[model samples]
Target: MTEFMFSLSALCRDSRARRGLAAVLLGCVGLVLPLAAAQAERIKDLASFTGVRENQLIGYGLVVGLDGSGDQVRQTPFTQQSLTNMLSQLGVTVPQGTNMQVKNVAAVMVTTRLPAFAQPGQSLDVVVSSMGNAKSLRGGTLLMTPLKGANGQVYALAQGNLLVGGAGASQGGASVQVNQLNGGIVPDGAIVERGVPTTYAQNGMVRLELNTNDFAVAQNVVSALNRRFGGQTATALNGRTIELRAPTDPQGQLAFLSQVENLNVTLPPARARVVINARTGSVVMNRTVMIDEAAIAYGNLSVTISPQQQVSQPTTPFGGGQTVVTNNTQIEMRSDNGSLKRVSTSANLADVVRALNALGATPQDLLSILQNLKSAGALRADLEVI
Candidate 1:
């Protein structure tokens, strides 16, 4: 009996070892799963299906019922012409050569975006902007306007009270205004009269266009889609285009595309780049930006001019010389002493920023320095000035 108990105890020990091994494996997998998921992004965020986009619609219209702050008839004859034409359409015939100087009407341009898959009877928001020299569009109503697409076909009609998000008061040659007065938005102001046919999937295949061009990203997306669906489900046509095989039936195609879009795709590292806004003096760098060892020196030079006005009188009281006005001007110039500073090689954005900041240069100065660095082949990234 003692021999039998010893064998049983050995078996129990082996069972416990197996259980512990299983638990360790599960823990490792649990930790790895989250890390993998964290690196992935939804396909929808990275790409858009072809033939799915908004269409721009624009029209010329008029805004009426202003508080005498509309366009001047003499300055903007278009306003007068538009008003006259609209009145004629309404059966109100005005005598020829009648100088109608109405201060309550203004000509405006209406614009809006016709969203993808929009149908008739859908309400859309429209923006009305003064095409003339209208003082203000507040408390105005947009007349019946036909919004046309690029094809010169009317797709929508806009007519509503302008909801201008601005206020102003002018009196005694002094004026105070907030926000903008020449532009306003009318919510649900336009009704769709026609629909633009959109075909996302053709011949049982849907094309996906990436927001950016990257071969690595495109391949990864193809791989992700294929793995989720089946082999040969997705094929990369180029760095920015991918062909996806979808179902033939409309309902089935939508369902399949939905699943494909939700699939998680691991993205490759972004290309190193620096964007500079020349007008705003803004410099932006991505995390992958790097810099090579270089030496930079910059300085500031300023000049100041002061003018003094004085009245010179004769030494003796009224000694045949009337009071004369004289002017004296002073000019001062200054320049900062520039010093050569060595910038060490940077492997990341933080180090690059630190090295650049050490020069104590302003944004405008930095812009010039970065451009020079790019020209000198020290900046290991593309420099884009916008």
Candidate 2:
């Protein structure tokens, strides 16, 4: 046979090899398509249990070692009481009814979070806040204090030199301050004395709760889970939770959870919301917010009222006022160019801001206009005023 005929015979003899190559090509295409469509999610952004939460722990503590920047003794009686208690604990006794003044002590409240599954000896950061009328907490060291949760259980013991991120100096009656004077943080200050019992693997089933409740998101989560561990292993319970069959061993289930927590999920779009801060003049809106056809107008009017008392004395005004006294008043009204301009807004955030600025309206005026628009049903979003 010629060379071409020989090659054709060889190809026909290995039909299974050609079929395997075709199957490999098809598999690659399937993988690439999904990769192009699937979105990436941060591991920290997804899945939390309904009841799993951090516990806040707080306790009254004493801050000492201040550089004459502690609480005033008269204003903060608690500071004196705490100092007295400390002295008594140290085998020192004061005469009854004797007044004692302390300049380096401050009564403070120590706060810290007992993270989930924190075991004994695990150290966490603590926040020390001056509960009394302390001028400042700079250069102060917090004494050992037991931090208790809402259930009145001491979960941790905090004691360390405070790291105040602020500074203040007062010489004479003038003072300069930066940041907060009454609050500070101590890194790794509190050591856990107990562990909170938490369950992750139990009853042969593990449940995963989404941070936000959305039917579409829950469905997508279930699909992702099922795709990873087969359809029979995972199922969605509702719009917020998903149940999965745990592996036979609890340790294995925990390992499975470690894997599951790293799984990526494309988050669903949040609900349309408009947040308005009246005090700071901040307005924020989501992409879903839409505006209907509406006309807006804003203006400013200022009225100045002044009153004067004129004392007239027959050519001796500065000498005597008993001769005659009269009261004079004057008022001036000025409108800030009350020219009305038509304002039309769109769903685009930039466009809405532009329309409001064109009218030269102040932040307060913008706030009023937004409220009026929301009341008139022209703003298609949840209007939240803060």
Candidate 3:
């Protein structure tokens, strides 16, 4: 039995060696391993064109069909006014000064992003948010609302059942909520009624915008495009944008551009970056962050003041003798014991974190230390505090 176990162990070890060899060979040939073994990502997951972006559309609407969780008519007078107007349009004669106590209606603002090349009759998702004193929008249905852009032109019409990602329960003036109380979304709820016209395919030239401003990456992109298509087809204008000439035929240019976007080019080495969120005391360092050798010694002093009062009884109801009472106050001071530790970090973020942790500082204290290090020219990375 022992011999059989040894054989099994040896077989496992051989398999691991073979896998390692194969991985090394693939890496030597400039092929990356899977994400589970490869380095951290430097390029963005999704890139957007600078000028090619979405247009925002907004409209005033009403959400209905809530389970007694809608806006209070007395608090939100606009909701009552809107309902009266809607009823009047339907030939319902509501007399003036008639008090409306509606609990099933909510005034909402509808918003949607119109993507590039959205044609008429195309469907788009819409977000509906309560703009009134509404309790909850769960299990609600939005009415047909005409969405308009900044130019006051109707772009789409939204009308669908809302999918609110929350739940609320109330009983006898006690209530509990699980998620947001005001917003919801409807998938494919808005149909485009108008489209902004712009020529993209038949234009003399097309522009490609890189998400990051890197001259080396932009040059590589241009070279890759020209190599795939033809010579002088693409030129790098700046670190962020590239201009390319398109074919006369629409289909040819579309096919050529589609191939150009999918070409996998190796990204350049990224710069050292560090992001600090002062509000939440968060510090994030990228893999490329580096630090020079430096010594840091920081300590915190805390002072506390406590007061105590004592009461004394009068002797024989103030018979020519009065008892005296005194107030006792105490002050305490404490300081942390920290040493000057030298830290040297380069390219590896683990070492930097370890050095910082050795100081026994809290998250709030780490922020100040990072700032001081950056100011002292020890940190060789961009320090961004937000």
Candidate 4:
């Protein structure tokens, strides 16, 4: 697994291997890997087109063929109205003032993501969600629905049986359920009727938007492109963007993109930063993160409270007898002795973690220790709480 994932890193490394940043994985355990040349990333993975993107389409529809698990019509009047309107369009008219009770039908919303460059007759997956109070959507078939885009134009038609991942059963006021029953998906359910048009800026010049905003990396990309093509072919517009000249013809431009996307360049060292997930007790740090010589005293304090209930009986010599309740509370506190230990600067994350682990610190303890080190100006990285 390591060889497969970091083969690029090994190829980009120097004559002697050195560890890079260690992002926290498996909780506190580090996902330490060699990121030899961070800038060796491919252009295709680093940037996207300026205007080419995906579009979202939504539509309101009905789900049918349920086994007595549909919405209650009286509670959701819109469901009844929608059903009535559909029936009217189909030439089925109920008599005036006729009461309608629908137990095998549910109002639902159908949604799909239309990809860029999608063509007519292309099929896309559709999501079906209950818009009314339905017990479950299991064993339901979604009716034919028209999916519309932001412009209110129908783009696709959807119809399929739902793939519900949940099941439920209820009897005598007792209920049990698994997963979610209010939502389901139909793979390849929507067929595109109309396709949205997209045009790229393939003229003489096009702009590149970096996946991340970094002046050093952007400058490196400009330099690499200029060296490969020509000095006048690439220029940096800002920290996050670069404009490069390309061939006018479609074939030439395609070949140019293929060649430039794989070129590797040495990257400036990443900034010193420590990312801490406050809720999850995970800390990740870059290789540049360092610490100064300092002394730390660590210990733990715990408090436990327990409640005990007792019943008291009173004897009233044949007159009356009564029972009374009494409560007893117990509180206990424990503290571990703290001793000062000297900590020195660490060159890599392995050394940093080893030092911290020697304290026998829990996750919460680790949080306090890092914060205290930051306050003392001993930690030389930006502490980001997330």
> Each candidate's lDDT (Cα)?
0.91, 0.79, 0.80, 0.83
lDDT by residue for model 3 (261-372), tens:
6665656667888898999998888767877877778788899999988777666775775666879999999998766777765436766777677667788888988899
Q: Lowest-lDDT window of 10 residues in candidate 2?
A: 1-10
Model 2 quality (TM-score): 0.80
Model 1: per-residue lDDT, tens digit, 1-386?
00101243555579786687678669878966886577699999999999999999999999999999899999999888888899999999989899998999999999999999999999999999998899999999999999999999999999999999998898999999999999999999999999999989889989999999999999999999888998799999999999999989989998998898798999877899999999999999987899888888788999999999999888997578788898999999999988778887886787788877777888999999999999999999999999
Scored by TM-score, the top model is 1
Clashing pairs in model 2, backbone N/Cα/C closer than 3 A:
none
Candidate 3 Cα misplacement greater than 4 A, ranges: 1-51, 172-174, 201-203, 300-335
> What does the lDDT read for residue 21 in candidate 2?
60
- Which parts of model 1 are misplaced by more than 4 Å? 1-39, 307-329
**Which of the two, 1 or 3, has more lDDT?**
1
Ranking by TM-score: 1, 2, 3, 4
* Model 4, CA-based lDDT: 0.83
Model 2 scores a C-alpha lDDT of 0.79
* Strongest candidate by lDDT: 1
lDDT of 4 by residue, 333-372 (tens): 9998887887767766766877777666788777888989
Candidate 2 local lDDT, 321-347, one digit each (tens) = 466679899999988655545555464
Q: List candidate 4 segments past 4 Å from native.
A: 1-34, 37-39, 69-81, 94-104, 130-135, 166-178, 305-341
